[model samples]
Target: MTASKTLNVGDKAPDFHLPDAEGRMISLSDYRGVPVVVYFYPKDDTPGCTAEACAFRDQYEDFKQVGAEVIGISSDAPDRHARFAGKHRLPFVLLSDQDGAVRKAYGVAATFGILPGRVTFVIDRDGVIGHIFSSQFRATRHVSEAIDVLGRLA
Candidate 1:
């Protein structure tokens, strides 16, 4: 895969329309005026991805309480995403970016020599990136850190 233009803090998130686990179309514009935590992962139901998803699942209520919405995106197809979300009981939507359009747009697609790096983009109510977290193993911390940042903004 070619290197993609990485989105940065304070940059407006690239708008996208991807099918969720249930095959319902979702878009960044739909959530305008709401803080959003959009996370990108490698695959659905994989060990690392599960950990990351579950971490967000565990924190779903807290996120909603803060007036934010959390959404996970991966290159998996909608059917795979459906099973994964059902199996894990994920509360938030799991977007299917099967063609990697959104994944590449975010610069998180796997490249020649690296596994797809995990990335989190925290968008404030005005739709500007407030924080970006990149990690593999300790993805749980990303959720915590995002909550902290959102709290400060709140």
Candidate 2:
């Protein structure tokens, strides 16, 4: 399910407070003053989601080198996120959007009938969205798109 409004480049990325894999509440406001790559995927351990996540994990250090943060969000519960992150050894944060309020706020819609949409937003240090990438099939492209935005921002 998506919202009536879809966020666009230069719009302020919507703020959200969701739980991470460890049940720790994390808010977008907390990452203020840093560029953030926020990605929304369908599920925890699915094929495409896993590929997208691992791609982010692989490039995590490069993001850090440029002073950016990476976060992944899904409707899965905290425990499921924990297991998925542990199994994949994902170094970045994975937040549980259990009620999917965050996804709705970001206007990430359902794709291919029921699968949740795959979207990535690169928010600059000022909190304005610098880039938006949406592709349900080409999952890994989200990471590269965000990285390119952050690279330019850096």
> Using lDDT as the measure, which candidate wins?
2
Give the TM-score of each candidate.
0.92, 0.96
lDDT of all the models against the reference?
Answer: 0.86, 0.91
Give the least accurate 10-residue stretch of model 2, judged by summed lDDT. 1-10
lDDT of 2 by residue, 2-71 (tens): 3547899999888889999999999999999999999999998899999999999998998999999999
User: Lowest summed lDDT over 10 consecutive residues: which window, candidate 1?
Assistant: 108-117
CA lDDT of 139 in candidate 1?
A: 70
Candidate 2 Cα errors over 4 Å, as ranges = 1-4
Show the colliding residue pairs in model 2.
none
lDDT of each residue in 1-154, candidate 1, tens digit only: 3336877898888888999977899998899999999998888878889988898999889999999999998888999998998998999988988778787877774634467768899998888999998877787787898899889879
Best by TM-score: 2
Q: C-alpha displacement of 136 in model 2, angstroms?
A: 0.4
